[model samples]
Target: MGGSTPTFGFPRELRILSSREYRHVFDSACFKVHGKGLLALACPNDVGHVRVGLVFSKKNARRAVDRNLLKRLTRESIRLQQHRLPAVDIVVLSRRGVLELDRQTLARQLHGMWRRLEKDVKRAADAKTSA
Candidate 1:
């Protein structure tokens, strides 16, 4: 297996780690995408790569297993779609009903959310440049 493959790994730099980083994205989020099971917030970043943060709160899923499952689904979806996503900081917040959904359903929803968010980010970026 080659290490140069973009799809082969989810690197640390591509993740939104630390409370400060998460707070920055949340406080400065430029656009938001709301899906049935998730809410995605996007903020432009100069890092030249897409970064994602997942928030599966206790209120979203009471059980630890359910929270873990939702986080896994969110992370997997983001990892697979990282290339397609815009160069922005994105935070995905899982909603209460997410735990009851199947993996396929959740993946589809997350993918759709990313696609829409990407478009919004691109539009915002374009507008900023044009202005």
Candidate 2:
């Protein structure tokens, strides 16, 4: 067995902590990618690392369990694709139909959203540098 297996976890540095940080992302997201069950918003950050925030409003997902499940799925998706993500704060919002979707569908949607988020961040950064 490997003595020191490479660890993979969502560290605090990679999470959008604090109410102010969440408010900032909610109030001023530069770009977004819309999916059937989710909406991902992205904005460049000075932290120089990709940070993720999950938002599952009670209005959208009624049950507490459902909300928690959505949060888990979102975090797992980010963990898997964090390497390909850029230095931006991404907030994922769950839609009304999110609970109805199966795990595979949710994963697929998350994957697509992540890809779009990456492209949007790159495009925005390029535009800023050019201007």
Please list all clashing residue pairs in model 2, or write none if there are none: none
Taking the tens digit of each residue's C-alpha lDDT, what string does model 2 give over 1-131? 88565445899999998899989988889988999978888788999878999889999998898889888988998888888889989888888688889989999999998898888888877888999
The TM-score that candidate 2 achieves is 0.89
- The regions of model 2 sitting more than 4 angstroms off are 1-7
RMSD of model 2 against the true structure: 2.8
* Residue-wise C-alpha lDDT for candidate 1, range 1-131, written one tens digit per residue: 99677763688998999999999999999989998878998888899988989888889888898888888778888888888888899898987677777888888888888888878877877888999
Which one wins on TM-score? 1
Model 1 segments beyond 4 Å from truth?
A: 1-5
Relative to the unseen true structure, what is the Cα RMSD of model 1? 1.9
lDDT of the structure predicted as candidate 1: 0.85
Name the TM-score of candidate 1. Answer: 0.90
Each candidate: RMSD: 1.9, 2.8
